[model samples]
Target: MDKAARKAILRELREQERARWWATLGLTSAQLDALHEHILANLIDCCSGELELSEQWANQVGVDWSRLEQALMELGGYCDCEVEANVCPD
Candidate 1:
């Protein structure tokens, strides 16, 4: 394949992977972005050593906390700072 075709294929694969990641967290891309921003801002002080900020963001945005938290933990995001660092779009 030409370079353009190869690039297109790679782009499509990335989109698919991003979609799956968000789906696993029961969130859309926008929701995840919002959550990330929230955590980033709140984490200026420090990580609460738990998912406190993430849960607050979920409640504020009407996201399913149980599903989101489970998915985050599975992805190695056990706290606000961890969520910002580990759980994010590609």
Candidate 2:
């Protein structure tokens, strides 16, 4: 209803959404990195930040694409929804 109340609601929603991202999956960055590296290692010689890893390789290496996608989406949500806008214009 008021400014303070709206801010409090936003903060609470942000926290809950963030928790679902990192905590619900129960995965650390290191673990996710390992999965990526494993896929990259077997499917790619060197990523160089430009490699299209195959789905077969992903299946073979057991990469958790859904979780990674979810994490990335959540990070985007944090940046877009929680961060102040236009602090530094491009």
Candidate 3:
């Protein structure tokens, strides 16, 4: 994907994650900021093939790459492999 396309996808992904966090726990703006940072770092790693995923972080937001990838793919994006998960264990 081009830079613009990649940026847009990341933006969408971040917004989706933000919405989930907001609805689930009503996180503060600062918390949202941190969450965005975490998401971006993980996203970069995944994209670059490093694949350094943090299950703790994933659990915090209630979704993983696999789940996010599914959501993105359903929205017409391409996913090359499995990601973490979207749901956390109860």
Candidate 4:
């Protein structure tokens, strides 16, 4: 695809992400704070090579892990092994 097309696609994706972030903002303060802590703990565990602990944290949070992971990524938290590379492989 051409540069303009690529740019348009990226912009659309970013807009969708922004919408998702806004949805998270609609959550109650308590819920939001809990989620932030859960995400933070998960990220820390993952970075420390504690995959099992990360999974446990997700389970304790009682949220869909996939959705929580996506939210964490959008919020600028890194968990993947490639975090130092600044690249998160899906």
Candidate 5:
């Protein structure tokens, strides 16, 4: 395949993988983006060493806290800062 074709194929595969990853956590790309932004903004103060900020954002956005927390924990996001560091889009 040509270089452009290869790049496009890789991009498509990445999109598919991202979709599957977010789907497993019951979150859409937009939701993840919002969550990332929210956590990032809050982390400016300090990481409460917990998911307090994440849970607040999830509650505001009407996402299931339990499910999201479970997924985050599985991905090594045991805290708000960890979530920003670990659970983010590429």
Candidate 6:
């Protein structure tokens, strides 16, 4: 597919995901960024390797962990590998 097509596809997917998130709970962009950082640093691999994910390479930013987890679960819990039933998703 062409670049424009790929961008459209990605944008559509994000819209769908955002809608799904809104349906579950109201969220703010900062909340999303917090959870994203947490997941990258903890759950995802950050090593320099062929399989390493670029998202995890950024510097850690301060975040309120509990609040961020709550927001992420509400917004993108299904996308998470597995969340502890008792604990909120990241």
C-alpha RMSD of candidate 6: 10.5
lDDT of 4 by residue, 1-90 (tens): 999999999999999876776575344446556644654545542355323433455577575667655655566544543322232233
Could you give candidate 5's per-residue lDDT for residues 1-90 as a string of tens digits?
A: 899999999999999988876977789888999998998876755687889999999899999999999998887788888888844332
lDDT per residue (tens digit) for residues 3-83 in model 6:
999999999999998777644434465654554555455554322322122123222344344454565445434333332
Best by TM-score: 1
TM-score of 2: 0.34
Ten consecutive residues with minimal summed lDDT in candidate 1? 81-90
Model 5 whole-model lDDT (C-alpha atoms): 0.85
| lDDT at residue 2 of model 4 (Cα atoms) | 100
Candidate 5 similarity to native, TM-score = 0.75
- Each prediction's TM-score versus the true structure: 0.81, 0.34, 0.29, 0.37, 0.75, 0.32
Which residue pairs collide in model 3, if any?
64-85, 66-83, 66-84
Regions of candidate 2 where Cα sits further than 4 Å from its true position: 28-90
lDDT of 1 at 31: 85
lDDT of each: 0.85, 0.46, 0.48, 0.53, 0.85, 0.46
**Model 6 clashing residue pairs (backbone):** none
- How do the residues 1-90 of candidate 3 rate in per-residue lDDT, one tens digit apiece? 799999999999999977865554344556545544664555643443322333335467675546544443453333221322322211
lDDT of 6: 0.46
lDDT of candidate 2 over 1-90, digit per residue (tens): 999999999999998875675574455646545544544445323332222332333355565656544554455422211111212222
Worst 10 residues of 2 by lDDT: 77-86
